[model samples]
Target: MTTPTAPLILFDDDHYMYVFEDQASAEAGWEMPDEFTVGFDAPARPLSMTGEPLDVRLALAGEVPEEAELRRLVADHCRGHLRGQVPPQATALADFVAALPREGR
Candidate 1:
């Protein structure tokens, strides 16, 4: 089978997050088995100059119906995914964005 593309990385002053190609492959979707668990020995290092720990999270979108809808979908999915994983109180917001296009970077 062909390998999947690397996921996108988006960082805020406070955290580092990742976005999958589609919602089904993301944590918000049902595709992952219930037994799944992240295995990182240490928390992700922050890309910010401050050198803080990154609070990584995921986002999903099956297929946005419109351009405006894509933003809402990403926001909603990210919010839910970050809830208990990050802090008791958290909201979705973009800070620094980076992604690899289909063409070679």
Candidate 2:
């Protein structure tokens, strides 16, 4: 049986990451650097599109960072990658991050 999967954002040596279809895909495609044994992987936490709050484990740099931190990281990624409004996937991710409710609100 195939394991159920969801969207994921994977980080490499660089500060940026891409939204992968799932964890398996990310693992399969990832080209790891020999210096670092493991890379960071976080659930995309795509709550805005579904309109349902999800309980997902947030992982980054071997530590669990807060959702706000994840949002900031994603925002930075989008800002750096966005051209004259081209990459629709990045645009979509930016929208998702924008839609997330502020923590403790």
Candidate 3:
């Protein structure tokens, strides 16, 4: 098991944030990139064996995301992952977001 690189790459889609080692791994194993859970901060960041900039790309992907970014990602994930009936996690996220004071409203 080789050590993962510091400056990783992230591929963010509608639902999940995929972690990659490099541009090549990101491109080759795009179909099955390592899934990153939004909002929840892990002890260590996810490492991908295989590996750029598409939807919402992050340069320092190894570092934790900011609060606003987390909220945005969570919202997007909930929106895309939700279907038929709303999942418990999605409902929780919605309630959490709703409780937060907005700028105007």
Instruction: Report lDDT per candidate.
Output: 0.28, 0.41, 0.37
TM-score of 2: 0.46
Candidate number that wins on lDDT, 1 or 2 = 2
RMSD of each: 15.0, 12.3, 12.0
Give the lowest summed-lDDT range of ten residues in model 2.
Answer: 46-55
For candidate 3, the per-residue lDDT at 25 reads: 45
Model 1 has a clash total of 0
Please write out the lDDT profile of model 3 over residues 33-76, one tens digit for every residue.
33422322221233333233222322233554354554555455
Candidate 1's error at 78, in angstroms? 1.8
Task: Name the weakest run of 10 consecutive residues (lDDT summed) in model 1.
Answer: 39-48
* Residue-wise C-alpha lDDT for candidate 1, range 1-105, written one tens digit per residue: 122223432323233234444322333422323222221101111111111133233322222223233233334435665553322122222221222121123
Poorly placed runs, candidate 3 (over 4 Å): 1-12, 17-65, 84-105
- For model 2, the stretches where C-alpha displacement exceeds 4 angstroms are 1-5, 33-65, 84-105
lDDT of 2 by residue, 45-103 (tens): 32111111232222233333244555666555557755443222333544653343222
lDDT of 2: 0.41
What is the TM-score of candidate 3?
A: 0.29
